[model samples]
Target: MFDTTRRRTLEWLGIGGAASIAGCASQAPTAEDTGASTSTAQSTSTPKPTDTDRVAADPADVPDPISRSESTHHDITLTTEEVVAEIEAGVTFSYMTFDGQVPGPMIRVRQGDTVSLTLENPPESQMGHNVDFHAVYGTGGGAVATTAAPGEANGMEFQARYPGAYIYHCAVTNLDYHISSGMFGMIVVELPEGLPPVDKEFYLGQHEIYTDKGVGESGHHGFSFENMANEQPTYVVFNGEKYPFTPDRYGTLSVEQGERVRVFLVDGGPNYSSNFHPIGNVWSKGYRDGSLEPPIEKHLQTAKVPPGSCFVGEMETPVPERIKLVDHALSRVARRGLLAEIDVAGEERPEIFDPNPDTAGSEDEEGSAY
Candidate 1:
């Protein structure tokens, strides 16, 4: 919902109209040049947005913080370097990765475990890369342990100190170089066993892709000296790949009716924000960083998830519907890159659309821009 003051300012500045027109004109490239004179100037960049969407885990998801730990060990290798991933079809660019996926791997550990990780940040730029787990209360949780040399692993030995969903991103803040480059991820601590088993669980995080390769200090290539001073990013994505990148045929979470699904969503924007929208399903319970509030029972069109946080969402699928997992920062939906899909395949019911009717004007923005 926009206020009158904001609407008046946009009208005076012609933001909505100009954005609409410019969006259309940007697609004039093909069409055999219909005799119309074209401008060579690229449209001015939209100022980077500070406000987007954010979410929190439910506290009820946390059994008891001081509870005993079952004590287990897991080896997670944190590596950053240029690797090629097909973000867009037929277009594989040098992208920084952790074992190869953009948002890194699905890191899950029970409440009581000693997690050790070997961070192999390949020598991309001269700058170093390191891991900082927000769960650690001391040594700034590894911020002091950042290393610049590639193949030079930044290793750490730490126990699960928190019970909720905490963030794990680069703490190196020189020009926000670490995050802007691609060195970031998430950390979720689960309750000691005995809770009901999840039918299926998945991992996802949000960030911007600045270069042709990807976003975050975790990219495969170094920023051009000319671009080092520039901050306008080109694409935003979920789990490191852009939308349509997860085209219907490629990336998707396939589910069926009557299935209970749990999504472990961790937001690592370290910048913008995110609005998690699961089209067609109303998440009844929201675990704010493992802290469960009374579940948000209403049909939610958009849910906010701020940076540096995580949450768990439980949804019971009653019928089939095409679900869009988007960063309701709608601009991010069409352009910024954080768009993914879920195809609910199965039979339908007459009651499916009544509770969450498709509103009058929820059309997503249209664009072919990266």
Candidate 2:
């Protein structure tokens, strides 16, 4: 089925590829200078098949929590590269990434630890790049210290003085363009003892993509500065693509019942905020804005995480069900394509939730309620 609602949203905003988009065919500096490859296709609402790669970082690819008791030194390296990847089955976009993934990789360290970070811009890169870490106490958060032009490398050392989760992103010129294109990630400076243990943990990033093309248009999409300025994102997504963690896409994030799960969410929004909520569950303990301080809030239904911020929340999966992670903005979920899912596999908790109490244990040939 076609997405009529999204189409209406475009119409209401007068966003059209040929008419309203202010920066039609205007690519980011890197994509433009490097002559990024794009398929030639007729603009249609229907998706066109693309051979491009995917940029969404696997939600399960989070670094293990710190296990050390004392402060230590760590070495980190981040490479800046531009990749042409698929936002969906048929649509492609050039993404600026820190190690070829959206939101890059999670950097984990103990509080008071010293970190030596290297930022590398390959010779083939068409633009300069640097990182501004929120956890750093230094000016520009090491942005000025690690600015690297193409074919260059820069390094800086900083101490993780505070204990909390923080965001790190490209802080080069036109950072909004770069961040919206996928150059952001999270860093966790944990207390000396580290965070409480949990059965599982997942890492995710939320950001918006502004393109001249609307939702389902085919062909390679270009970044739109005008749309970004207007704060009218063509897509608001988790990881890199719309509904990347949903069952219909890359498959739902799996968790067993009776387990406690931790989610580290980094909001990389160049604009807009995330009203993070987990359907079918609540944040049993939420560290507001990624704060690691004790006395975390309890039973938070939705947490409002703004741009360039982070949120760490825990959930208890006591029953088998599909819990949807969404931006409670609702319209973003319905139109802008932002969603994730957690599939809890275990016995049902009929005592808690029952959809068909009348049928009770009765089952049909399919082993489902009749």
Candidate 3:
């Protein structure tokens, strides 16, 4: 049977091809889509590639799809602790996180794997939160999974049913509170088996935090999924911490002229949009919205990462140097989100080697954010 919801979302993603969707698509896709549409169908949204549309893709460039695998189970524990006892730091708020990180840890399993998660929330009481995984076997990932009661944590189990990227977050109190409080992450349920691991992978997601500044001691903010569409993160980030915090933890990305760097941006917490920038350019665009679709070739400075998405792109740093990665939104980059570095060194380039800032444009509006 055809799925009307998936059809609408796919069309909106500019999939199937819409050149220049950098602008909005005039009309919405209809339910009549039979999946008979060509993979190369014009977006009817973006500008068609010029007469020189088809670029000769070298077989060497397109690596083979990694063999996906399936395993019986994957179990893990996630905890949220206040770094400084009762005091809140950074944005001056104690957040609900997994494994002590905002976006939590990156978990991968085969298509049919049985993944179990045990959660632990800190003592400081707030709204209760629970896990709701999109890749689970039923009910949009167990939204009915009763939330953890204050200090008490809960456990849930589900089988990976699909072979695409799926999102997991605290769907505790509707789509409102939990998400805004920084409770979300992604699980790449490998297709049956598992996809090949790239040279390097990093997990980052957009987050929304609710806060009010006070002249006295910094007020502890209460983050929730409220006004996420409007109150974007004063800070955007990679993994859990901000820029400098990443290098020592996740380490810096090192690459040569043609090595491929896979950057995985998952949205576990729903709030801010993530902007990822590689020094030179993205060498490959293999997956979109968590599935292995086709190869996209883009060489730009800033890349927008949406929620529930796990986009894999490549980077070929022209020369060895320090490259900066930040949320494309200037304010968040400066405030509470994520920032990091890449070590690109010892490289030489041909005549056409250069960096262009005026490349990719952020065309997507705020409400339909990632």
* Each candidate structure's count of clashing pairs: 39, 0, 30
C-alpha lDDT values of all predictions: 0.52, 0.81, 0.48
Candidate 1, TM-score vs. the true structure? 0.66
| Model 3: how far residue 114 lies from native, Å | 2.1
**What ranges in model 3 sit over 4 Å off?**
1-70, 80-91, 120-126, 151-153, 174-177, 214-232, 245-258, 268-272, 275-279, 293-304, 334-338, 350-370
Decreasing TM-score order of the candidates: 2, 1, 3
Most accurate candidate by TM-score: 2
lDDT tens digits, residue span 1-370, model 3: 1122322322333344322121222343232221212122311222222322111111122223436332667677665443211112322443445544456555677677777776655456443445667677655365434245446655677777777666777654334334444566666766654555555555555554443332112333333222243554433445434453335444665555445566666654454445555533453454655664334445545555575555555565545556566566656555564556667666545345533334645565343211
lDDT of 3 at 348: 46
- lDDT of predicted model 1: 0.52
Cα error, residue 276 of model 3, in Å, equals: 4.3
Q: By descending lDDT, how would the candidates be arranged?
A: 2, 1, 3
Better of 1 and 3 by lDDT: 1
